[model samples]
Target: AQSVTQPDIHITVSEGASLELRCNYSYGATPYLFWYVQSPGQGLQLLLKYFSGDTLVQGIKGFEAEFKRSQSSFNLRKPSVHWSDAAEYFCAFFTGGGNKLTFGTGTQLKVEL
Candidate 1:
């Protein structure tokens, strides 16, 4: 079984501040994890992915994540968040039992000046 958990339902960060979103996952094998961002009432966009290789992965919009196998975590980070970065972020992974992706509930980001 593979599952993702984003404990934070909502988060607020000041503009230009560094941000980190928590994610935890569980699986039977080496998991392939992914991060996606979506605007309100929109589809998800891939942020980054961790298939196999170096634990750290980078993606668009200056986002990055580090996969920690021992802790079963893949937390997303940004050096400095912008106002436009405010959106619903999701953590997902393809299940071994099924080909489709199972996503976490999601974490909505709010940028405040």
Candidate 2:
């Protein structure tokens, strides 16, 4: 089975500042990784994904993530965060058998002025 762990339960960053959210996964082989963001009262939105190819993957909202097989990590990064970027971020792994996803506990991002 595959699982995801987000060390930081909550994070705070100033507007226009850089941000990084850590995510670690456990799996036997290379697994499908994904980053999703959910605003208050909104559904989960796909931020980025990594299945193969490049180690660095870019997603919407100026977000990017690097898949490091050695570290078993796929951390999300943003050069400059916007106020609207404040939301709950989730790291997930696709099982690929039944279209199921195992998600992390989530990290709540608070944007300060």
Candidate 3:
């Protein structure tokens, strides 16, 4: 079965710090990977995606992720976190042979002052 699991339900970080969100997936084939950021009660926005080529991909808001095939993981990272970065992050994979995407539960990022 192809699925995704985000172990962390929520994470807290101080303003101007670093952040990382874990993402693990199980898929039979190498699928299209994506990271989305959603604010409180807001729709999802595409942060970045990894289809082929480089393993490390950069995204908006100074975010990046590295695709690891061995571990079946694609982790999101940010060098310096900001107050505006406080939002929910989700890892999604294109599966079921099409445009449909399966998303993880979600990891709420809270930025403290």
Candidate 4:
């Protein structure tokens, strides 16, 4: 069975500080990995994705993640976060067959001034 897990249920970081969100996955083969951010009452926006190329991938809003196959991890990191960045982030994976997607429970980020 393939699954994605986000250890943190919630995270609070001061505005303009660095942020890191932990993500781990269990899959038999290399899967399509993605990070999405969703603002309150809105649809999720794709932050980045790792298909089959480089281990490091960058995305919108100054976000980047490194995929470590051995570690089974794809963690998101931001050097400096903004208050607007506060939202729910979900780590998702695709099985690469039917366009099906599995999402983590999600991590809510709170930006403190």
The candidate that achieves the highest lDDT relative to the unseen native structure: 2
Q: Could you give the candidate ranking by lDDT, starting with the highest? A: 2, 4, 3, 1
Order the candidate numbers by TM-score, best to worst. Answer: 3, 4, 2, 1
For candidate 1, write residues 6-67 as lDDT tens digits: 99999999999999999998888877899999998898899999999999999999999999
Candidate no. 2 TM-score: 0.96
List the RMSD of every prediction in angstroms.
Answer: 1.1, 1.1, 0.7, 0.9
List per-prediction Cα lDDT, in the order shown.
0.92, 0.96, 0.94, 0.95
Error of 4 at 10 (Å): 0.2
- Candidate 4 global Cα RMSD: 0.9
Candidate 1: lDDT of 91? 95
TM-scores of the candidates are 0.95, 0.96, 0.97, 0.97
Tens-digit lDDT string for candidate 2 (69-100): 99999999999999999999999998767389
Model 4: lDDT to the true structure: 0.95
Candidate 3 backbone clash number: 0
Residue pairs of candidate 2 with colliding backbone atoms: none
Model 4, range 1-113, lDDT digits (tens) per residue?
78999999999999999999999999898988999999999999999999988999999999999999999999999999999999999999997583898999999999999
Candidate 1 versus truth, CA RMSD in Å, comes to 1.1
